[model samples]
Target chain A: MCELMALSANVPTDIRFSFSGLCPRGGVTGPHRDGFGICFYEHGGLREFKDYLPSCQSAIAEFLKSYAIRSKTILSHIRQANVGGVSLENTHPFQRELWGKVWTFAHNGQMPIEQVPQPSYYQPVGTTDSEKIFCWILSELRSAFNADVCISQVSAYLHSLCNRLNALGINNILLSDGDAIFAFCSTKLHWVARKAPFGEAQLRDCDLSIDFASVNSDDHVSVVIATEPLTKNEQWLAMKSGEGRMFVNGESSWHDFGPEIIHKKSEPTKIAS
Target chain B: MCELMALSANVPTDIRFSFSGLCPRGGVTGPHRDGFGICFYEHGGLREFKDYLPSCQSAIAEFLKSYAIRSKTILSHIRQANVGGVSLENTHPFQRELWGKVWTFAHNGQMPIEQVPQPSYYQPVGTTDSEKIFCWILSELRSAFNADVCISQVSAYLHSLCNRLNALGINNILLSDGDAIFAFCSTKLHWVARKAPFGEAQLRDCDLSIDFASVNSDDHVSVVIATEPLTKNEQWLAMKSGEGRMFVNGESSWHDFGPEIIHKKSEPTKIAS
Candidate 1:
């Protein structure tokens, strides 16, 4: 399995501190040394930085840690390469355009390539089962909606689709369309929402720490989601299997936990820290 | 008018030398400081760096100039926005996926928005006439061809559509599909192909100079295309009005100059140096 990280904020906020904690896991602290990618979405457009190199060694990844780039929504992934080769085309955080908006998706688990639906509107540029599933998901969304619809009215259908994909295999995912973020958990996922009266939080992977009370005001709210809890002191809400949630403007817009569906678990691989 | 730069090389080559010259024109030496963008194609995947900010002041652009990134094909643009706002979504070197390949297009002139065809398979995410034209071009290509066809058979139809767009207004453009670079000149464009017996060349935009003999062997060949001559010492081939050329593997594959088409030219504005 791969590691996924996502953040949503009411005001434009930087993820450098959180990203700092995750970068070490790319190779120095974890086994996911195959590749890594990240996307930042602001008012102008979405900008992506992906490298086939491990984040620990990539200069671009180092630059990102120092750039202080701020955005409203962000999605990132570090791969261990189960279904696809270690190449740029196979990098996660796959992007496409639908309804005049750029849509981005990143997945953490593998599925049966033959079981995924063939694409019509969107096609995978890489030979990965994850990318094919993303294209298939987008194609289904395009077919279901013609024009812009209220996102609140959009979650039920999405929940059903997420439930369907869960049957094939593990499906931990993070997706966004510039305006909103959608996350689905099949096995493991955790999230934390920080707002007014925020206090200090410490990273679990790195020695660095930040005091939110000193940095944030009463009006700001931010939410961060990851495959595992990223902070040590913060209370992370762990999702049950077959659970999904949507975030807009740093707040949970909708959530659902479908009836449980059974699937056999594959043997887990351990990597050195 | 804006500036365009493209490079095609038989082997992986760095464009930082040529890009250094154009960097000054982005804001310091010339006026077209609306925005700037560049794309590098390496190992069948494309990565782009664009800034809504002026290139002269953008740290990302500076990082790009310092990084010794090498690729087989590269395309870049510096915009003096005319038909679109200075936004990231409206930045040049617009990209779309067609037939599992990323197609990039950058334009230097304007066209009537109403005269542009409505898109079917592709649509513009931004409100730029240039982006609309690009989407229309991709839409047309997706409809006419379903699978891989000979490059020679494809250029004739492309020439016709470009000619049609030229009838409405100026349409100087640089386009690529990873395999090749296509350039069309409605007002001014130039190209230079360098190979064995390489000699000294000096930048027209900067005081820097390079002697190719020290860096390259006898077999290396590279083709550079720009809106105007970029070097004073090198002989540059100027493209005639309505002339178009395609480059693959550092050599010309096809070229055409259609009959003269009339479109009113607007007085050019001089940018601050």
Candidate 2:
């Protein structure tokens, strides 16, 4: 298993605070120390940083901590390497281009590589089952629709694919195409939406804290999803097993909770602080 | 226009010295300072660093200069932005995966985007004419051959595509699949190979000199290709107007001079130091 984290915001926001809490889990505080990767969607393109070194020891990770790159959507993962060998190619957050959009995917669970279907459109450069699964998903998306199709039109198909993968094992996934974030949970996933009335929060794994009220603007709304709650004083909503959600501009566009799917346009829910 | 640089080496080598010369052209010494990108093919995987800021002002470029990641093959580009707007997506050294290998491409000249045929397989993530040409080439490759085809078998087809693009405008190109480099020149491209008896060399753009004899091993061999001669002391070979050459393991695998092709299997040229 690995740790997955993501952010979706109405404005460009940095993930330094959340990333700091997750770094310790890579080696110092937990066993997940194989490699790590992070992708920030900025300026209508993707900026990716990946290393085979553990996050605790990676120089790139240390540089990233001090470098504040603001982005509206971000996806990151720290791996423990269960199925593939430790290599730069096996690092998480694999990226591909489809329909003139850069799509990134990162997985947090181990699936049977042999059981996964081979992809037709995209091919995996790495030997990880995570990469194979990502390619398979992209291949399916390309086969089902044309290049001009909107993502909202294929939400049902994407959710079906997520459910099919969830049936095999824990398939906590975070996927983004620079515009929106698609999160699916199989075993463990939690999220927190921060808007107005932001207060202070303390890190769970490290000796650090951030005062959100001082840092955020009144109209700034953002949602952070992670494998586990990164803060102690925040209320995090745990997603039920087999639940899938799509977030755009810091708001949940739709929620597929088992059988029933609820669109945010029809049933808008207030963001839980 | 842009500054293009590439390296093909028998062993893993760092391109810091050549890159140092190219960095200043982004903003300080020259006017081609829109953005910069570099991709290092290391450990059968690719590590890329790109910034929209000028290379002279980019923090990532500064960090990369000190990081010293070694690779057997590398490609770098600094853009001036002629057709496309200055953005991360428009940055050079565009990458795509084909035959399970990450192929990188960088162009130093402009081509008419309207005249170029649209690609059917790979889509351009950016709005640059350079990217469209790269997509068209890859799409043609995928259409002509199967995924399992060897690169050597498609060298002639690739050369034909290069010639086709060269007819439109200046199309100096540097492309690689991590194992070999394919360099084509329509107007300006130069290369220099370094071998056992390495000597001191001075940079033309920067006030720095390096005694390669002390730093490189006796068996080390590397070929550096750039849009113009990077070193003042080195003897660089300028490719003909429509010449295309492929280098592997620091040696010219084949050289196509106009209508005739010379295979390395028949005439292996010695490394020129």
The parts of candidate 2 lying over 4 Å away from their true place are: A259-273, B259-273
- Stretches of candidate 1 exceeding 4 Å from the true structure: A150-153, A267-273, B150-153, B267-273
Task: Give one digit per residue, the lDDT tens place, for model 2 in B39-112.
Answer: 98875588788898999999999888888888889999999998898989999889888888788899987655
Q: How much of the true contact map at the interface does candidate 1 reproduce, as a fraction?
A: 0.26
Clashes of each: 0, 0
> Candidate 2 chain A — worst ten consecutive residues by lDDT sum?
A264-273
Query: Which candidate number would show the highest lDDT if scored against the true structure?
Result: 2
List model 2 lDDT by residue over A100-149, tens digit each.
88899999876668767789889999898899999999999999888886
lDDT at A184 for candidate 2? 87
Q: In model 2, how large is the Cα lDDT of residue B172?
A: 83
* Candidate 1 DockQ, CA atoms: 0.53
Candidate 2 backbone collisions, by pair: none
lDDT of 1 by residue, B1-273 (tens): 688999999988989889998888989988879889999888557778888888888878888888877888899999898777887888889888788877889898876566678888777888888889899888889889975753345777787777777777788888888888888888888999999899999999889999999888888999999987889989899988778788898988899988665556773322111
